[model samples]
Target: MPVFVKKVLAWGSLAFLIYFMAFRPEGAAQMFKAIGAALMMMAQGLGDFLTSLMT
Candidate 1:
């Protein structure tokens, strides 16, 4: 994409996301919780794999 178009999309998405999250605080909380869980699971899986590899 062109630089101008990329900038427009970045700003547009930021504005839309801010509006959506602000409109539904509960939804934002749930979304963050899900994201945190996913990160935790990924980290645990990675650690296990590395430990097994080292062993």
Candidate 2:
């Protein structure tokens, strides 16, 4: 991607995160928790798949 587009996306994401954190701290926490859970699940699934392939 172009530098301009990258900067725009970075700034936009930062602004959105700040807004979410300031205006809805609880919601932001919950969202982060959900994201963590999803990532954990994905990791576990990948591990299981790798184990199955080896066995």
Candidate 3:
């Protein structure tokens, strides 16, 4: 189980690295900014769904 978790984390990090390097290499600053924006949107959508279920 530990080994599986480690492999999953490693693969996930590697995927992020490859995606940022290959597809978004205009600049590190901008790449991180886009990632943050995407995460915020994802979080907001998730929160909205959860709140709707409660209400």
Q: Which stretches of candidate 2 lie over 4 Å from their true place?
A: none
Off by over 4 Å in 1: none
lDDT, candidate 1, residue 20?
74
Residue-pair clashes per candidate: 0, 0, 0
Instruction: Decide which is better by TM-score, 2 or 3.
Output: 2
lDDT tens per residue, model 2, 1-55: 9999999999999999999999999999999999999999999999999999999
Best by TM-score: 2
1 or 2, which is superior by TM-score?
A: 2
What is the lDDT ranking, best to worst? Answer: 2, 1, 3
For model 2, how big is the CA root-mean-square deviation?
1.0
Task: Please provide TM-scores, in order, for all candidate models, with all chains considered together.
Answer: 0.82, 0.88, 0.54
Candidate ranking (TM-score, best to worst) = 2, 1, 3
After superposition, candidate 3 runs with Cα above 4 Å error: 1-26
By summed lDDT, the worst window of 10 consecutive residues in model 1 runs over: 16-25
